[model samples]
Target: MKSSPIGGDEHPRPLIREVVVINKQGIHARPAALFVKTATKFRADIGIEKEGEVVNGKSIIGLLMLAAGEGTKLTLTAQGQDAEKALAELSKLFEDKFSED
Candidate 1:
């Protein structure tokens, strides 16, 4: 996931926010799949970042490579018409612990 810098003058348009993994298992295959499914619902592009590295949120392999653990912090970013809403809802998904509620 290539994210346009949130503050940098990079990318004419930018959308980025940080979210924590509330899921006890972190971004494992199952949760990653769910995340990708939700991400694909939006027209905007979605990406995830951890430990300074970024990868496509819709890509299972890429997300798995992140090796993110429970409570690990991540940055989510989107670009396009629904960027803002997509980011918000996706962040909420994390906050909700992947719908464990």
Candidate 2:
């Protein structure tokens, strides 16, 4: 939940957030598509990390490759003018269980 600027003042550091997948089905195709769709709405560069693997958040294939399941913890990183807003919306998706039951 900490969004500190890194790389000094010259560069905007990516905002990082830790979120857990709470949906019953986790991040399957539908959820991944939803995530990518939402991510694409922002100009920030989005990255989703699980364990040590990081993938572009706007790529549905990348998201599916993570194989993240319920209770899985993922790190979301965004860098750009709307980085904070992007992280907030993305994290809200996780918090809301991707709008699934």
Q: Pick the candidate with the highest lDDT.
A: 2
- The TM-scores, one per candidate, come to 0.82, 0.88
Give the clash count for model 2. Answer: 0
Enumerate clash totals for all models, in the order shown: 2, 0
Q: lDDT per residue, candidate 2, 1-101, as tens digits?
A: 33345643433789999999999999998899999999999878999999999999999999999999999999999998778899999999998888899
Candidate RMSDs in Å, in order, are 5.9, 5.1
- The candidate that achieves the highest TM-score relative to the unseen native structure: 2
List candidate 1 stretches off by more than 4 Å. Answer: 1-12
Candidate lDDT values, in order: 0.82, 0.91
lDDT at 21, model 1: 86
What's the lDDT for residue 27 in model 1?
A: 81
* Worst 10-residue lDDT window, candidate 1: 3-12
